[model samples]
Target: MSAREEVLARLRAALAGAPPVVPAPGPVPRRQGDRPPGRPELVELLRQRLVDYRAEVHRAAGADVAGTVAAILAAAGARTLVVPAGLPADWRPGTVEVVVDEDLPAARLAGLDAVLTAAAVAVAETGTIVLDAGADQGRRALSLLPDLHVCVVRPAQVVGIVPEALDRLTPGRPLTWISGPSATSDIELSRVEGVHGPRRLHVVLTDG
Candidate 1:
């Protein structure tokens, strides 16, 4: 037989004894009561996990968010800041120049010192924060290009695990899952930070 015919016959023979394929079942919806841990516990877990992941964590009450944000920026020595159009005006400090306009070029964004925004949900177990391109969160580029990112996460937005966080997210939106500052290791295992994203990640956990 020809080479092509031989190959086809062998493939058919291998599949001939296989059982019929079955479609996988779809995901079942979880009940509302399929809850995570209590708010305080989850928040604490998230704080620990994020710290372990090498991210800076801070706690604040809703009324104190502005002051906390200001302190973080000042400590980082950020001269210029950017925020999404829908970001709460009070979240920014009056000391630095704030830019809230849209359609900023990548070059311009890369020149900024830091970007600040809120998160959609955070996974405590995984130390991850999900940004679903929400108004406060802005576009993915806003979070990626900057050298520093300060994300404000409310206690109520913390989930126990990844699946729980995924269930809360809308799949259609652009989702950015951040665990820590971007880092990659070379073949020799020398770690280099900020290869792809922010070099520094700061999480401000606020109670609303």
Candidate 2:
């Protein structure tokens, strides 16, 4: 036999009696949602947790969503705002210049003003907001490059804890979990804000 065929024949001969490889099993599902016993409790706990993170939180009714959002932008003096493609038209404020999320480069996005979005989920116990780049939430770069971020979260989307949040999320998605504004402390224990992401984070909790 030729050299290539001889090598293949020997390899086949070597494994002829070998057992088939079996895959290891995955971990068993664990108990989740250990805090915030009820829906109302969950929402209240989420608000408290977010407040502890130093994030601005606003409560609004469903019918007043547009007005609340507009007021928030105006109060921040944001003249330019980035809107994701799937964002609801009613959520846009009429007074600001709107930029659509279209895979813009980081440098380009950094120059713009703030970004407004709806979250995929929020964890009450951890005070975390997750964005999966779905619909109202744009690509990861959109939220990261801006100096300010305003997010709208519904009470229905709030979960009691981290594991509960994970159960709602799809696997292998690009997820961004934000607790508050981007901040860090140096070796001297000096705190600084706006170093990595937005320096300001505003969350509007809707009861409707």
Candidate 3:
């Protein structure tokens, strides 16, 4: 049997006599007004949260998204960019050399300059963005290995709170929640970025 199959078989055997575990209660739902926040308000809130996390935030109209993306890459001096197969064509900057992910090796992905993706949903309150390995968002590795991650988020995808964001995601899908760039602190409280993922996060909040 394959290594993965063997591992699962062993795990199942070990749990054969184990008693069932019950899941705890979920979060208390918050009551909402008859009307949610306006789109512009949600977008602004999300931008504020992202900026507080030290992420670069840029705004663009629907027609100007491509130009905005191009400018960001140019400013970052990124030459080689990797993206998912289904990322919107207009979002890919013409100036940079864009490569589509094909289950590339980790080492190869780490060599690339940056990665661009479309977020599944974003929480305005917490400055969190979620990717569900969707068509526009590829495997988790694509975002983790690169030094720079440029994620495109639409205004419609921004939710007011965590519970609302959770309701929009599927439990079975591989989900990546990013509040900012990857960072950690040592015992001495020395902050280091990009320990587990990208060091720089650039979020493009587009009207489209």
Candidate 4:
């Protein structure tokens, strides 16, 4: 018999007496609450880790985010700012040359100094901003191409852990998890930013 035929015969013989292959049921993993114990000062821990992730985190009360954001953008010498469609009007000021998303050309996006938006969730442990491509945040390109990014996250939207944030995010669809500015290390150990995404990422935690 040919090699294929021999293999088939062996497979048939091996399975001939074997019980129908059945998947063994395993115990399901319990949720976070059922796991081991660890108590932490979430706010402080989150801030500490965010620093480690190379992200700049600013904390302010909810209402003050707009002013703080405006100041930050201005300080960066940013002239053109891209605002999402559904973003709250007060999240940014009226004076700035606000650029809205509406089939913006490559030249406009390239010239934009910063792109600002509200995040779906922020993982404090990893300094990650979750964007669901929602109206408040445009397609993945808007945030990725900009030189600087200003993401406004609410206190309640900030999770103390990564798994918690994963639970909050949906599995399907275009999800962008930004830890910090795009960076890479060369063989010589030289570091580069703005290679694939933003060179600087500034986060504003607005108390929800």
- In TM-score terms, which candidate is top? 1
Per-candidate TM-score against the hidden true structure: 0.83, 0.81, 0.82, 0.78
Ranking 2 against 3 by TM-score, winner? 3
Model 4's TM-score against the true structure: 0.78
Off by over 4 Å in 4: 1-40, 189-192
Writing each residue's lDDT as its tens digit, candidate 2 over 119-195 gives 99998888899999898998989988888899999887898878888888998989999998897887479666667
Which of the two candidates, 1 or 3, achieves a greater TM-score against the reference?
A: 1
- Looking at model 2, report the run of 10 residues with the lowest lDDT sum: 29-38
Ranking under lDDT, best-scoring first? Answer: 3, 1, 2, 4
lDDT of 3: 0.88
Q: Candidate 4: global Cα-lDDT?
A: 0.76
lDDT of 3 by residue, 39-136 (tens): 77888988999998889999888787778888988998899999999998888888889999998999999999999999999988889999999989
Whose lDDT is higher: candidate 3's or candidate 4's?
3
- Lowest lDDT sum, 10 consecutive residues, model 4, at 31-40
In candidate 3, list every pair of residues with a backbone clash: none
lDDT of 1: 0.87
Query: What is the lDDT, from 0 to 100, of the residue 40 in candidate 3?
Result: 79
